[model samples]
Target chain A: MKKFEHEVIFCIVNAGFSDAVMDAAREFGARGGTVIRARGTANMEAEKLFGITVQPEKELVMILVKSAIKEDILHALYRAVGLNTPGQGIAFSMPVDQVVGLSEAPIEPKAEEQAE
Target chain B: MSEAITKKEKTPIRARAARAPRGSKRIEQVTAPHKLKLLFTIVNRQKAELYADLLQAYDVNMQMFLSAQGTASTEMLQYLGLGDDEKVVIASIIREDLAADALHMLEEKFRTIKNGKGIAYTVPMSGTIGVAVYQFLCNHRGDRV
Candidate 1:
């Protein structure tokens, strides 16, 4: 039998949208995600373009899941957050060469005593 | 509530300093004849933004980033059991002085310190393509036009 492969998706978004993005990710099939604060570098141009203040405040979220579910999770993020929209966010997945803790033996059910 | 208000009012100077424009000379100052490689990571997959932020602090005109998967020791792999994850590598040219500050920030902020979480590092840049490109990278963000 061929061994199964696992993939993980990592994403970083403006901090303001972290919750919404992560929530949608979990809804799709992601077990969980880690969120971290970050700052944006290119956004400095916003000050020149629009006189409005732009905060580089950013949040990064990483999710690990089976490669089979990559498309579903990506779509879920697109629909929920709309990466096309400014500050909405982006998502992508990479193949995992080696995985640990993913292989576990199945557990047997306890025998039941039936009285006729 | 009163205590919370007092804490908010007493915000540290460093927090306030972080909000201001990083030195406008970051671009020019960082590139002005320096021998340092601006090492960065794209494991989080936010290149453009991260680069932009760096430019605000240093004058890194030219940079190259490579996609890489995060790798861990077999023991760490088994202990943490990160199923399938990879780390990305981003390397750029920067001045020696700017490289030190960048490394400092990376150590204090990006790396796993008190929390023991994510991690990254930087190395000194040794060689380069040409002087013109080197100057351009350092001169882009100089306060003077």
Candidate 2:
């Protein structure tokens, strides 16, 4: 079996909160992610059990991160958008077999870093 | 700036590894051992429809697009010609082997089309809900489905 080096972390949150998801992830070394517009289908019973109105307008954020930082990014995402928050997001990850087109080029130094 | 453009120009070389689909070869030969893989092709909003159309030729039956925002830094996004920052995530159900051909096609389009650069990766799917649904998702153009 081939070992995987990257994982695509999927976070589904209430619409308009995708930016919040990315902000949380960026702090933890995630380069970025893509958002897929989606809708929530939780039955009323589940929504009532969770004590939150389920927002049908949802945003599925797909962030491809190195496996080493997967846990941190997931945790960051949970804190930022988990069910307790208005976003009421759920997050999970899947292993990636192969990737092409994106690369790990060096990010340009920010102003402070460049000054140093 | 020129260096960035050069890297973008050379991006196709990386995808050359996926063998171009040969007409003479039978589809069954490449698809026999493989199962369905989720092909996540993220591209600019403008090019999503074209990709979706091209993928169907390679046995991809289901393709869903999600409006997205790219997280690349400002400079990087500028270099990739994604000034608007709008993106589309095309999630397609493609067989493991056929994905290679689709990926090759994506690379070609990326090189030729202005601001057509995109990222493509696959995650292996473990199981499907039903055989009928699976067959439909992997529709082989009415040939031996």
Candidate 3:
């Protein structure tokens, strides 16, 4: 059965590379994306924490892709942007329940196996 | 000199009904504090800048804009904390027609329908203070003299 769903791909990465990231997304089946500057959080412990400055240089990218093409797009991004590599960035997707405007076709999900 | 105390204000006189509704007793009239206010919100900080730019390009006047973290998920079932991603909120009080135009511009430019980059929503306000402030906001884009 076909179902309607949304794919949300967003991540924060090193700054000054928004152009590159957008280019990669277009190559990965995304029509367009937006980038914003941001700062990473401080997660270090208090006592052991030395005065190392966490880089405030960060860019956030969000791309909406078809659910069927999500995996392909993610893999393409990972390969192109060194996402899985150190200091490259982090990216993930969650199902968007409802939206207006950029709605798209639904995809069929695999059938579950019945226990005998 | 002691000012004379005015007699308790008499009940205001009702105006003669020029055009009465046919038979029906119900009266429909727009009330005071009916000005429309719009709150445009976006979570993606990047899209925020673009939106602001688009508004500027369109010469849309903005009354006020505020930036802050989103608190929508604070009471969610999961303790899912709010991420460090900051949200930019733009608020403007405009005439109803202008608000509609602003919404159209947002849809045309931002494409909020698409996935995660950002989403924009608007809410209406009932009223505002000061004619001077109102005039200033209405002409904020510098397009209107």
Candidate 4:
């Protein structure tokens, strides 16, 4: 099996700011991303600790990108929607072992491909 | 109740082990420092429920999803839809072994189902908050921990 050196990056920001996260990520080499509706549970004390207003409504943008360009994308995301900014977004990445269903040549050939 | 105790006493060895005290309920799932993975499956909105239901058969206990506007290239989007390409992203935390099987099932479905092409991948989780949380997320339900 062909192993994919990919990173799944998640960016959580206040609602309506996912476009910024996706735009910043696209600045690097990210082809596309998925946005999930979420809500943050930051209270007044949390706001005091973080020194940023916490919007309860949150949007999580998940982008799958090659490991080679992970850093660039994250850095861009930070500048674009970091906590200091109104977006108050945080970004992190996780390692991905397998990728499927992309038009790119399937890692394990299907029976038809194998026959061919 | 006496009946409850009777049932407990009559429980099989494995079931008894499941209810065993001192945090030994998940003998198999928690045997090693096994970290679960988050399986992300993005598919067309129409088939989200079908895929989510299929995932449940694979011992996936916890799963959630929300509509996502895919950022596919314009040409690809046009091919997939007239203009709107609504997608659903399903996030499920599963044990590594089950995660692999779920990915394989998804691959097969994408190949066979019409208009069901999508992407699925796994991201290893670093830590879980509690043993019970871990058990529930990994589908080790009803076991005393």
TM-score for chain A as predicted in candidate 3 = 0.68
Candidate 4 per-residue lDDT, tens place, B1-145, comes to 9999888887786576767765554555565644688888999999999999999998788898878877654566578667556899888888888877788999999999998888999877778898878878877765554
lDDT of 1 at A93: 69
For candidate 2, give the lDDT.
0.83
> How do the residues B23-122 of candidate 3 rate in per-residue lDDT, one tens digit apiece?
5454545334325545343545555656676665433466355554432222353356545346665544455545556666666655543433445444
The 10-residue segment with the lowest total lDDT in model 1 chain A: A101-110
Judging by DockQ against the true structure, name the best candidate.
4
Give each model a TM-score. Answer: 0.37, 0.74, 0.39, 0.69
TM-score, ranked from best to worst: 2, 4, 3, 1
Please tell me the TM-score of chain A for candidate 1: 0.69
Question: For model 3, which pairs clash?
Answer: A102-B113
Q: Say which candidate scores most in TM-score.
A: 2
iRMSD per model? 12.7, 1.7, 10.0, 1.6
Q: Mind giving the per-residue lDDT tens digits that candidate 1 earns over A6-88?
A: 66676767666766776676665555454556676666586789875555787666566677878888887777666565555
Candidate 2 residues lying further than 4 Å off, grouped into runs, are A46-52, A109-112, B1-33, B75-82, B140-145
